[model samples]
Target: MKDILEIRIHGRGGQGAKTASQFIVEAALDQGKYIKAFPEYGPERRGAPVAAFARISDKPIHTYAPITNPDIVLVIDNTLIGFVDVTKGLTNKGILIVNTCEESSKMKEKTKFKGNVYTVDATNISIKLLGKNLPNISMLGALVKIANNISLESLKNKIKEKFLKKIGEEKTEKTIESLIKGYDEVR
Candidate 1:
């Protein structure tokens, strides 16, 4: 990974993309890295297109805007590919993780993604494990596995700390379980 890691997350308004960025910011903070996580959007309603960004480094962060050339891009909504250029800002060595089963060759051919592209059925896993269609936790699991900057345990701890009270014990447990399942499934 670079000394400064930039991550961009894409999803619909209710899919937890912003939450994923916030969780990652917390996890990176736990790892002692300077980080900034924030969302960019025109509207703040569910089902609208939403994006969140996270920048992590050993030094201080000073900007909060849409990441235009991120090292990593996480796509929580596969359908958004048609409407949004999710891969537009990806760096040459950047990697893309999409919530789809599409083959790498296909994605590259379709999106012209010059860098590595990885896919996972995040929505399926989320629905199966959480009984809902939210992709944040699952995509976060996949992100952790691919990035390898933060341990799964660290993310688990953040989840507990971040969502325990908001979602309650049962939902939080299921969310963590879904994250683990996504981590395992991606590899």
Candidate 2:
């Protein structure tokens, strides 16, 4: 991990992009890192395109603006590849973690992205385990794997702490399972 790391998350509304960003922030904060997480959306509605930004650093982060050049980009919706410039402003050495059943090379080719690419079938995992299309939880696992800045145990603890009260233990467990599957399956 460097002094500062910026991450951009892309997903549609109702897909938990904001929640994913919050989890990252919480995990980083739990590790005593300075962090900021926020979401950018237009005409709040389900299925609308949404972007969430997260900044993590050992030192204070001065900027409050959306990340322009992210060290990592997580695409929770692979369909956004053509619809949006998901790779715009990504660093040349940045890592791209995408939720897709397809190969990373194919996704890179389709998006014309020249960077390290990782893919996971988060949607499938979520549907199987949680019976929903929410891939953010699973994507978090993939992000942890790719970013390597936050530990998996820290993230799981945060997820349990945040979601347990809202979704109950059984569902939270399923979500964590989906996340772990994503972590192991992302390549």
Candidate 3:
């Protein structure tokens, strides 16, 4: 991780993109890192494309603006590849993580991204582990793994802390399980 790492996450409105961003920042905060998290919405509807931003730094963050050039980009919805320029600001040295069954080579052809790309089947992981299509929690696992700034244990604990009261212990465990699978299975 660099002195500061900025991340951009792409997903549909109801896909939990905002939640993922908050989780990333919250976990980073738990590590005593300065952080920021926010969302950008196109339409106010459920299926509309949305973007979320998370900034993590070891020192005090001075910039409050949206990340124009992110260090890492995470696409929670593969359908937005063509519809949205998810790689618009990613550098050749940056990392791109996508939630899809497609290979990285295929993604490179589609997105024309020259950076290191990682593809993970977060949907299937969530379905198998959480019994739902909630890719947000599992995607957190991939985010932490690729970013390498936030600890996986910190993230899982954060999720548990946030969801334990709202979703209970059983569902929280499933969410953590999906996240772990995504962390281990991303390629």
Candidate 4:
């Protein structure tokens, strides 16, 4: 991972973008990595666009400003591509991950981004495993694939620890399965 791997996640309200950011930070913390997460509410209403920022590093972090040039960007909802500048500050060497069924090539044309664009059907993965459309957790699986700072086991264990009681064993297991599917199926 880079010394500082900054990430921005875009999604609609209630889509779990904030939760995803928290997950990333918590998992990184478990590995003793310096991290930060910030959630910016869009319209103060559900269904409105929202974004969350996360920073992971090997050393102590000091920056408190918003991430303008993210090393990676995750779009939990593909529909926000046109409405939000998902690739606003992403560079040619940076990575862009989106929860869409579209191919990377097509996404490149749609977003006009030349960097590495990865697509995962997190919506379907979540619905199939969790019986819902919450793709935020699944997006973490995709992030795990690209982020070397945190191991997959660490993320899964963290999720299980955090969600087991609130969501029960069955649903928590399903969520983990959805996350694994997102990890394995990202392209």
lDDT of 1 by residue, 25-74 (tens): 89989989899888895779998888999998888877665577899999
Q: So what's the TM-score on candidate 1?
A: 0.92
How many clashing residue pairs appear in each of the predictions shown?
0, 0, 0, 0
- Model 3 error, position 70 (Å): 0.2
lDDT of 3 by residue, 9-51 (tens): 9999899999999998998899999999989856667989999
Candidate 1 — worst ten consecutive residues by lDDT sum?
60-69
Candidate 1: regions farther than 4 A off: 64-66
lDDT of 2 at 55: 93
lDDT tens digits, residues 1-187, model 2?
4678999999998999999999999999999999999889678888888999999998999987768989999999998889889999976698899999999999889988888999999999999999989899999999998888899999999989988999999999998898899889999
Candidate-wise lDDT, in order: 0.86, 0.91, 0.89, 0.90
Order the numbered candidates by lDDT, best leading.
Answer: 2, 4, 3, 1
Q: What TM-score goes with each of the models?
A: 0.92, 0.96, 0.97, 0.97
Tell me the alpha-carbon RMSD of every candidate: 1.6, 1.2, 1.1, 1.1
lDDT (Cα, tens digit) per residue for candidate 4, span 52-77: 99999889999898899999999999
Which pairs of residues have clashing backbones in candidate 3?
none
Residue pairs with backbone overlap in model 4: none
